[model samples]
Target: MKVIRARSAGFCWGVERAIEIAREYATQGKRPVFTDGPLIHNSQMMERLEAEGIREVGDYLSQTSLEFGLTDAEKQRAVMVVRAHGISPERRGYLKQLGMKFRDATCPDVGSIAGRIKLHARKGYTTVIFGDPKHPEVIGLMGYTEGRGHVISTEKDIDFLPPLEDKICMVSQSTMFTFDFERLAQYLRQRYPGALVFNTICGATRERQSDVLVLAKQGAEAIVVIGGRHSANTVKLAALVEKQKLPCYHVETAAELDLEQLGQYKVIGVTAGASTPGFLIDEACEKLAST
Candidate 1:
């Protein structure tokens, strides 16, 4: 079998930065360190961090308290690390009110989108987010718009939007499908002629998606996508490959690969999500090569 791996597979700059920051904190041996959420979507990486004495806290106040598991006195000595997905401004303020210290690990690309929304919202514009409303990144971006933000997963959702006389500013989740975002942006502009649109999807995501499209077009018999099940970007990659009419398996680790299924393919392509570690990608590639 011929095994081909996507060059763009594995960690992007932002996830790498967040992991580096967390590791640095872990080595300091100072106060206990906790992330606002799993630093990234990969469960294996989260487990590795936990083994290194780093922990994750849930988003809700009650969940945070439970996950923290520290007394008031102990809590005062803890340092919280904001995840790469970032948190809402309101949540940041609430953390400050609790006298908690946190280090922001928000991706610069995600930060820029939030900044743009806040700037436009201050000028009385409504923010339209082309993303899943429940996504952590979108949740954080919405905070910048006060109460004037709306989320739409598809172009159809735009029809359900309340009529807005105010100017509109649109941005996308950093990991959204590039083509879908453009289509949605076009629809919004047709309806609101003066609406401002920003292509906030990260370059890494675009390149990864493009790479997979190319592989599928090249007639790879099957494609293997590696990442956590909860990873939205990984799910999108798998869906994109399937849309191309090629067999695709979305697996978290090499162990999940089906030897019998993969054996049927003479040439297979491999790719991974942004949050995936390089080692996991290598392992998957090696497994495919062996088969």
Candidate 2:
């Protein structure tokens, strides 16, 4: 089978920056660098980072309180990093009380969204976020809404909301589909005239989304999406492939690929999420191409 790789497949600038921040502390400071959650969504990369003395300290969602016991000396030597997905202001407060060196590795794009939300919330705007309610990024952004945040993933979610006489602001999680966000924005505007809307999906996410179409146009019979199962952006890529009426094989590693099933396709396309490492993408592509 012929293999076509996406130009914008792996590690986005934000994820790369977050990793670099953690690595610098771990390597240069020679201290254990701990993150509130998985620094990035990819488990393979996290495993590699663990080997380098970077450890995960909190739960996957960044909701639960950190339970590990650290001595005063350990706390003084350790550095706690906020993950790329970010965390709520309340969570931030709790983490800071741990008395460790604190570093925020939140993506700048997410930071921008949080800043906008904080600004409008101070002015008493009801914030409507279009994203998975459980997502760490959405949860973190909600903290900026000052108790006026509502998360909606569907049109029905919007219909169910109570009347809002106050000003309304709408924004999306950084990895949402542009079309879905715009459609919801239009829907929101119809109900709340003069509602403020911001398309805060990062440019890298848009580029990756657009590249899936490019793969389809390049005559790929099927596409392979490589990333962690919990990775929102990677799942979206698989869904996007299915939307194009092509077979999508979503796998964490090349070993997960069903070679017999995939062998039926003459041309296959490959793409990875922002959190995916280049090594994983290369392995998947090489496995598919060699077969």
Q: CA lDDT of each candidate? A: 0.88, 0.92
Q: Summarize candidate 1's per-residue lDDT along 158-218 as a digit string, tens digits.
A: 9999999849999999999988999999999999999999999999899999999878766
Best by TM-score: 2
Deviation of model 1 at 216, angstroms:
2.8
| lDDT minimum window of 10 residues, candidate 1 | 60-69
Candidate 1, superposed: residue stretches over 4 Å from native: 28-30, 60-62, 66-73, 217-219
lDDT of 2 at 52: 95
Which pairs clash in the backbone of model 2?
Answer: none
lDDT of 2 by residue, 1-291 (tens): 899999999999999999999999999549999998888898999999999999987644545567468789988999999988888899898889889999999999999999999999999899999999989899899999999999999999999989896499999999999999999999988888889999999999999999999999999999999999999999999899999999899999999999999999999999999999999999999999988
TM per prediction:
0.94, 0.96
* Candidate achieving the largest lDDT: 2
